[model samples]
Target chain A: MRELLERKLVFVTGKGGVGKSTIAASLALLAAQQGKRTLVGEIDAKGNLADFFETGPTAFKERELAPNLWGMSMDTEESLKEYLSLQLKIPLLAKVGVLARTFDFVANAAPGVKEILTVGKFLWEVREGHYDLVVVDAVASGHITGQLAAPQAIQELVQVGMVRDQTDWMIEILGDHDQTGAVIVAAPEEMPVNETLELAARLREETVVELAAVVANRVLPELFGRGEEEVFEALAADDRTPSPADLLGAAVGGPVRPILDGAQLAVTLRRTRGVHLARLRDELPTGTPLLYVPYLFQRSHGARATRQVAEHLAEELGY
Target chain B: MAARQRTASAGSVEQLLAAKEIVIHCGSGGVGKTTTAAAVAAMAAVHLGGKVLVLTVDPAKRLANALGLEAFGNVETQVPRQAFLDAGAEPRGELWAAMLDTKESWDDLVRRHAPDAGTRDAILANPLYKNITGRFVQSHDYIAMERLYEIHASGRFDLIVVDTPPTRNAIDFLEAPERMADFFSSRLLRWLTVPARSRVLSMASKPFYSVADRILGSKFLEDIAEFFLLFQTMYKGFVIRAEAVARTLADHRTTFVVVSTLESAPVREAEFFIDALDDRGLHLGAVVLNKVLPPWFLDEGTTATAKAMVADAVSLAKVLPEELGSPDQVGRVLREVGESFLNFQVVANREAEMRAELSAAPEVVASVPYFDHDITDLAGLLQLGEQIWR
Candidate 1:
């Protein structure tokens, strides 16, 4: 199987609030850190992606995010404009500008035009070799299949047109597993993990893209190893004389019960998600690479979290 | 774990559930929105005497099984009395559950609103109708609200709690009814459906079609126009229904509850939703904060103690009796425990900041602490509900 970064174009999607954009930014950061020239694009302009890079807002035009990484936000209108001008070779800028704007309006109402335009821009970057990797922070999990299949849907809906001609190549790029793959970012919870597994099957069955890998994000670290939990229990026991809690309380000169209770909460939280992790692993396709990103207890999701997640991804990939 | 029975008093979620005829829960996905909605409905059924219905969208099958039902669909299924009894609750009112089937609901709307059977069947059979109804972003929002309106008018349930689908924009669900009305009555629809020859002959629309025709294909354009022309027969019915749904949303008897975790994204969305509700004069009943870390994690003394334990782990380990483990192993355990607390404290502090920054909260702001386990049964939901009840 090809490595995730080796794929020319990767679309990352997950259920909302599952840290989909963070994983996309981190994966792109990791790719750039590994010396690949990468383009990271966000499909929505909610502007959170800029927060991930801790940079000023990214516009429709590409801007340098790091030495090897560039970023942009997808504007379907702008994408349509570019596609029209480039495809038609129309010299009249003002006229074609109005024409494209009107067409963009129709695209909004048309079944698949807007979706195709969004996906087409990223594929264009790959086909033109503008970057070694194009990372798309695509729409959330439930909407990705519609986005991925937009090109073919447009092709079928429009029998003869310039749009029809353009879709033929887009479909080829998307169909080639070596050139394009999708990564699912999921947390170890019932809904996200289930969505990831379902998306994996749907990607193969409903869309042209292949599942590159499954990223298990925000996985809790195990707090105890082997018999250490027994020691923790013994220390926390209320009946014991001069219990570890008491000694620790005396030593620290404050109550230790809450600290111990916090640890217990951590243990239980990890244990609960552990069931979900096991289910996710067992149910995923056998050869699919499952990567885990440790949950970061950070102040905010900005540049720092992005870098930290990149480091974890690097280590998980056997860097 | 025993759930504490907090005061279910005047300003609690309990009061809102009892008073309001309709409560709609909205939030970003994966923030326990469905669970929060179900839990509150369970409490309403248990504490307040009336028929209560929870209309959920795309619930996990385990949730149905937890309610002691195999599954349910567009039709409301009454949760068995035995299920509540097993959950240790002698319910005062009947509890019912239903999942939204968007396609079925849309078909029903057509059947009800269409002028006659011929027009209804023609509209339903249109290929573009199927495509638009299924793939249109606004259709789900419209259908969900439409179904709610239908059920609310039926007066079968004393209280109805709805879990809205996750919409990318903050106000899309709220604006859905008006948008649907505007769409059917818009100039775009009229222009698109203009007779094909007249469309070409009109000097104003010639450029539009010449451009649209090449890109979309003449056949596809004709199909869309034909479909819209068929739909135009029921425009009055749709417009009237949309107005009724919008009125229901803004009615004093209806209220909106925004559920979110203290995570930044959901909080941002929650605030947006709250503001939108306030702007529209819709009652913002309560804000339910789910999966909040316990306040003990923020105790000043606990922070200092966790730090001291991590910094002086070697000495702290030696103070313990030796039967548990070797001193080195004890030290390792001590360090891990201390570090884990410190790690969680970072998140806990952030949560505190998010909670603090949450301004303009209504009179009833409730917080549910993080549960280590998923709420799978009615008892578990009731347990969760009690935490936020007051």
Candidate 2:
């Protein structure tokens, strides 16, 4: 996992709501804590990392969120402008009213253009060698694959020019096993884990990127052991109510009903979660390390909590 | 309990289903949007007695599995009647499921909108068309919505539940028609097509063509010229259909149901969507907060009793070996369960607070407690439906 972190560019993606953004933030924080300058690029204009960092929404330009951690929210429109002006050498085309009007049409006509621009910009950071690591909080699995495969796809279509030359560089960096890798985030549940495996297969087939690590979020703790399982089964078979004689023998006090119900719910939830965990382990490719992050029951994932997650990952990853 | 009361009154998901013809479930990924859509479709068919079609543009196949469909296709397929019955649903109306095939839909749209067979065939065979239709950013979203409008107009299903892709793509699904309209009306295509229209215009645009050919290759310019001419002939119909789709989306019967979770990121994404939908004047009726932790039984009156039980249970566990099992194991299990109940309360309260804050928004927010397992079967979906309507 640490070796996975050593890649110059780490693209993080998974099924939505699996805490991909949080995992990216945690990984970035951990890398930074290891004395590496890390830049985490968020794909949407709305910055989720801002909340995790407990800062204002990340600006379009990169800004330091922590000592060695920097964050930037990638707006496709802004990236298009930047790409046109800087990479394509058409500084005024992206600004002119008429051409800008055409920009939308062109962008729509070429779907991966925006994706290419976003990914190109991220790869550009890696090319600049300004940071030790570039972590991208990517879009959901299917689209993220499109983004990762964009350079090669476009290169195959376009035969010549600066765009081709630039994509060549992207292909080189992305295909370099030691330089680029992707970390997939998944929950312990079935669909997310299944999607994670699917994404891994797609990445292996379509892109030149490596499947680095799988981070399973919200893994519930074990609440029942072998003996306890038998005990719970026996309890379930018996009537829930205690006999009058038994109540008198114990001389117990307080409201027992709620506690008993809570215990039952807890045991059921834990037992079910264990099944999912087992499936995840069984389905995942053998020898591919899967890191489990315990469920953190909190109201908000503010900077403090994000750092706490980072600490947990750091410990598990042996950073 | 108080929070649940407010959410129940803010807007009933059941009422939203009964009232609306189209229920669009838009949210970020992994928030149970697919499950919510499937459950809503099932509920509408069984409880509301309306024929329903649930379409998912998400590339993931979870919806098919969630609906317990043995097979799913680009075309709508009826969910097995036996599965619905097994789930204890008295489904009076039909439930159909489909996954979007962007390429197929794009091809169909071009064929329908084209002026003639030759033009349509030419457009279909164009390499640029193939690449653009398949790779374009909003093409998938746009085509899904186009197909949706077509299906809705056919009057086959009384209710259409859409489980959209991730946030950006879902937003694109809403705005795609407008983008299509803009593209059809843009000046660049008109200029590009001028060379193919008239010999005089071709001569007049020779310098422009020469420059473009020099930069992009003569073959590329020829391909563009051919594509533009074919596209120009069909532009009117395309614009009209795009505008019609936009109008259909804004229809009062069309309601956007945002599915989110208690996480700040998802909640924030939901807020962004709600605000965007409001700006567009689209009706937003319900916000489904999926996988919320259930509240504990402890409240002000019960807290003292719960604490007393914890103490009593711990003491009784220490002496339980004499009566039942090993004292150490019994004591450990009792203490862990007792302490874990408190932890559950804390998690539940935090989630409740977040739900309360979100409920203050204009849309009705309904919550479904985090299930013990993934809801990938019809019975599980029915269970979620009951919770949503509960």
Candidate 3:
């Protein structure tokens, strides 16, 4: 908690199916619980954060999801509207609206402008100082590099204007090592690990933002001692043992042996996951913390699941 | 016409593969595109009796799992071929699958397509080219398309099924090869080259020029200059190649099957992709809606009543939401629950409507229902095949 509070903005990104929104929400909840005003922002155009908050998609504007915890799923055009109205002092529905729409159309037509606007909105919120911490649930690792570099990319393309000024300010905020931190979330798989390392390297090269941590989600918990492998083998080989089919009767209980066999399978899965974690740690830049999240059987979508993930993160962050 | 042969609800994908050399599957993320693509390729190999290769740009391991392979690198592996043999089939057709690695594939393409050894090395070593090809745009889809083109040209398979990247990137990738070829031939590139050469030619600061020369070799710069010197010739060849690919993609021998789940976003994405294909003169062969929720289940109240009377109450918490107590809260919960059910029904109904709309244009081959387990392995894939093939 102390470490997380030390940074102004926290960027959490991971592979697509790795529960990034869950982690970001949990972090926001943790921060708010510590009495810090925290905001969890999601830039996914699909508006998933509201769903995570048990709200409708229409409930996307800034709203208090929990005590001291605000949530907003960014709509690029809406954010642009808000930015123009508030920051630029443009009228809400004036001629500027038409111009803003035109700008949005042009930006949307450009390759990476949506990403730029999304990230730019985060930068805008950080500058407002309305929250003690801002946790951005960024896109998947595959597109995150472009998302992070978007301000600079757009700044280079559009020179000598208010847009450039905003981009410059964003670049400064993002490039400040003490102000921002980036966490790469991944699963214990070859492709995700490879992409995580690549993302870490890019962040190190392009920005001063600290590559603070890597959260490896859905890791199978290691159970049983090394010798349990042989024990399981011996159990399977026992000649006098009743067949699993015999044990499947009402008297013996339903599917106990199959569940036990599944536990045995889990052991191998855990071992494989551990090996990948070790390899990722070895390959990652030294001093970058690696956090492993055990796979919970339940779906990690609601408040209960977010709390569970927060507990894991709390332990990892040494809160 | 190609449109005449396609079915609105084409019963099976078998006919679609008959004449098509390539089938591109496009959909939103989490829609089982990988599984559907794998199933189509598997069907081609096992049922259609044609050699097939499934190419995927999904960073997820779904493709490898669907094919029952332990892992898939950039290179094609021969696992499905073995699966067919094990199924008591003759294995007359071979199945191969590969995961696209964008940067590596880009490097390979540059090396293969460059005019000369000097130009190849120059482009490989140029930081600008490296940035442009490697990290400039979303490279996953572009590389996937390039790999598809390579596989098509190799003549190793009679049919190729490409599981496209998610919607946005897939669109970008489909257009990238032509875009990149055009950029290589554009006047803007010619303008950037003059500045690139000045650092090499200017002898006023010999040491700085030498350093620049070393980084981008003087000889390499000269070759790049010469290559662009004959830019028209190179551009003509690239345009010709692109045209050939475009024509091949539009031919009756190719099909575009848009995969979606029986969900709102996916259906919308599929509709958009179908329209885009039509606008581009591409033909739609099938629409495979996967992982659809079952239309009906045993009523919970009846099951609860039975269990309660028998002195063994069945736990409904796992299968049903908990009673939230207050009527309003329950109403809210029900409303939320109702929305999901409504959305599912809406998607299913809309799919039927879409099929009817597309009936005049092409056949709707199959609609796969949602399964209890994740489609993560060959066994699951075989299960998927059973559902679709019938």
Candidate 4:
């Protein structure tokens, strides 16, 4: 039941700046570490998946970022080109080349075309059995619903033709809850949590994909247990004889008040975040898994940060 | 304490807001851009006298409540004067807010530019119009700019602070007006509708349509062609308005205020956006760095104290009065306190590095300290306003 990676296709999405790419990269890395042949693709052209992997830039052509883990950035034009060549079976590359030039011109004029091409490529990979798992670092939540609903939208829009014919199979794959799922990355903030809950409901009302899990990123660790907080508060209280700030300053041979203040800030941060996290848990459908990844106080995004996130994800999933 | 390298920066943000008619807040999403825009606008209404309007996009629900909006939509609503007084502000100007309703705005555009009422109804009834515009990533960007133009032309507010939609690209909205113009005049639209208008399939477009019709089907071709043909009727009107919108954005009176946190990714994006504004001759007003940590976290002497507290936790705990707690528990708290400071130090260092690496030369850079709680009301907003007022 907790096997999000077991799905042939997983879409990772969230509000922007919620570390959607980071979670997607880590999920793929974890799958690969467990010896699954994983292909992680980013839907946005200017994705930072490469930065997370600490690898060279990715393109339409897949590059192996690690053993058993491959990375690629989705380009709808390239996708349209590949899709056309496959559908057209035009051996003379020049004919298909002319059509590719008109791709953007036509795609922009027609609505659902670019979205279908992007969704179609991922479904194509899953259908072709190119990898054991396909993790897509999908667009932010504001846009993910459109991508998820594209096949159905296309089917309803385009009544006939090859595109219409392709829609049936994509819908079949997407509608199967066991095979296709969306992992929403949330950061337990007011806006992000509200957006996550809205997206969860929208996913059910709008798309065929299942809500696999909600990965809460940058979850602040609770600094004090039950009685410890009160004691810490009393120690910092001003009226006490030889105030704790003074006592600690003399004992440590310098000011330790800032350190104490830092702890207070940490506790308050966690307390405020807890309210939102609780709301998320209560509002979500019963039994929807919520994974926690602690705040990584690292220098920057890189392979190490990605690995640390992966390890925490594995622990949350009871690996 | 503020790593404000540019000694002259803070004054410029205040001055820029005071002078500019339109201050567009642009940045990557979730960097608190909406909040910053509201605070800046609030500050303007209080300190700098004018009829100020904040054109926000997708603000948090609490924010709407804070602004005293019951059910916010495309309609511009004035912030209650009572709200100003309650915030302890003796405002010399009025503050207004309007949330961008994409669907409503698109409908408004159709009504405004449709050559005839029949054409307006037909375009409104077009299914493609409803789904496609809602799905189009750039449509939101385009509508926002277009609406800004619409409001500015009406001369309603002396200052309009726009919180730009979260765009996939840096200058998406900046180029949206031209794109709308280009889209209406595009050869693709002409080609598709030319065949429909005269029912003449030319030799050149025959093969292309066959391929397109095969994938899209003949019926869809009709729907898309019909949709564009209806839109084409408004071409002259739309093109002129779009040009005017473009002019409004490019005018020196309209400035760009880039907002971001000091996280590595956001700072990088902010710098990139700043450079984009610079290259295009759009006035780069200020870069607002939000949720910045206090400098005390990075103090060298404080780090030494934290280290000492962690190293001699038991002794430090014993030295404290018994009113605090048991020696063992107090020691645990002491150790935890030291460890937490060290933990925050890592992030503080990261933020400092990110700030140091920020390469864009924005006229002003206002740093806002991280507030421990969410700002939910007008008073709360103006409180936030104080931090960036400098």
Give the per-residue lDDT digits (tens) of candidate 4, residues A175-210: 898889999999979999999999999999999989
lDDT per residue (tens digit) for residues B109-148 in model 4: 9999999999999999999999877876578999999999
Candidate 4, residue B47: Cα displacement in angstroms equals 1.2
How big a share of the true inter-chain contacts is recovered in candidate 4? 0.81
Model 1 Cα shift for residue A308 (angstroms):
0.5
DockQ of each: 0.69, 0.42, 0.06, 0.77
TM-score of chain B of 4: 0.96
- Tens-place lDDT per residue, model 2, B1-390, is 234445334557777778889888888777888788888888888888767998887655666776777668789999988889888877988899988888888898988999999999999998788777877657777887898899999898899998875646447779989988887787776776665665465565565455444333445445556776777788899899999999999999999988888777777678778888989999988888988865554364445544554566556655433434565555555555566667677677776666776666554667798786667788888888888874
User: lDDT of model 4 at residue B119?
Assistant: 99
Q: Which lDDT value does model 4 have at A133?
A: 95
> Worst lDDT window (10 residues) for model 1 chain B?
B1-10
Per-residue lDDT for A1-319 in model 3, tens only?
Answer: 2265567798998765556777788888888888889888987655667655675553347888889989987787777677667655644467556545644643433444567678877777788898888999887776677778877765554444455556768888888767788988887765567678888988877755678678888776555444434433433333543532232223223322332333344454567667767789899988777887776644224678677888888888788
Q: In order, what fnat does every candidate score?
A: 0.67, 0.37, 0.00, 0.81
Indicate the residue-level lDDT of A36 in model 4. Answer: 94
Residue B222 error for model 1, in Å? 0.7
Residue pairs with backbone overlap in model 4: none
Task: Estimate, for each residue in B53-139, the C-alpha lDDT of model 3 and write its tens digit.
Answer: 888777556457656677887888877556655554555577888877777887787666677887677666754354344444445
Model 1 stretches astray by more than 4 angstroms: A90-92, A95-101, B1-10, B197-200
User: Which has the better DockQ: candidate 1, or candidate 2?
Assistant: 1
TM value for model 4: 0.97
Model 4 alpha-carbon drift over 4 Å, by segment: B1-4, B9-12
In order, the B-chain TM-scores come to: 0.96, 0.85, 0.71, 0.96
